[model samples]
Target: MRRAASMGMTTPTTPVAIDPADLAGVFDRYARDLLRYCTRRVGEQVAEDVVAETFLVAYERRDRYDASRGEVLPWLYGIATNLLRRHRRTEIRALRALAHADGGARAAEGPAQRATDRVDAERAVGRLSAVLAKLPRRQRDVLMLFAVAELEYAEIAEALQIPLGSVQSALHRARAKVRAALAEGDAR
Candidate 1:
């Protein structure tokens, strides 16, 4: 190495390369949750693709990630949420169908007491989806990231790249709409 005084100008240090281990850690921690969230939003068939693509995108952009800002799971979730947006119509249609399906006996759940619990759970999910489908896309996204993903308001704001106040406002509106819908359903 040349002496600083002799060289007059010190060469800049090389940029740090992203470690593969970091990405691996992210994948290990978040892949299952990402897949589950995607499946909930878009169904099982395309959830895998969405989650795979999410990790690929995260890996490619790993250098830009700011660990100081937040955790990897929210970032992965944001990516998965964006991918799910492309399949919104498919999700809405699928939810609509599910909401309307008669609680028929399934191959797995035989006509036992257990099936009753399963059917009740399915109906609850179906009703939730039917209500979710009616929400504005932005409001729905904010709601899901908060309610389904169980993210904090700050995390949702960071993940969605929106103001914290906007996240709050959207969540409030979405919750109100959902409560209204559920109440209306109860009356029926």
Candidate 2:
């Protein structure tokens, strides 16, 4: 090995080919679920790019995966979370934008007061979105992983690379704030 290094000649290690089937299997198993999770954060338009980058990163770092730690979904979510950080401001803006959105496309054309139910629902969602936007990043992440991704506390911890206790506390705080915001009244 030293002689080879000194001579700038490579040792003859067998090259391993990545199977197309394995890649297909991975994408098939998790793409839809990951897409839904991504869509909820960044909207449908940007979700595809995020998921694609996630799989690309996962494939590039395949050597780092440890099956003993947990399942693939959590790992994939972990990658998604890291990638989402780059879009954090985008998410906040989207949520704020959504809050201001009419939010009741199905309602019949009329003055805003005519659709009381629609107005109420819109306000409710606006409050919720405002609350979510105000949450600390860690708390929001824990909440999203648990609420949207349907991961358990342990899985959330693994995904976010945080302690289980931290996950529990962050989620707890997030829920409390949301509940309070929703209960308080309209977003206006």
- Superposed by TM-score, candidate 2 places the C-alpha of residue 58 at a distance from the truth, in angstroms, of 0.3
* lDDT of residue 106 for candidate 1: 54
Q: Model 2 over residues 17-45: C-alpha lDDT tens digits?
A: 33334556677778998999989988887
TM-score of each: 0.80, 0.80
Query: lDDT score, residue 26, model 2?
Result: 70
Q: lDDT tens string, model 1, 78-145?
A: 88888889889988898888777655545245645555667767766677788988899889889988
Model 1 stretches with alpha carbons more than 4 Å out: 1-18, 104-120
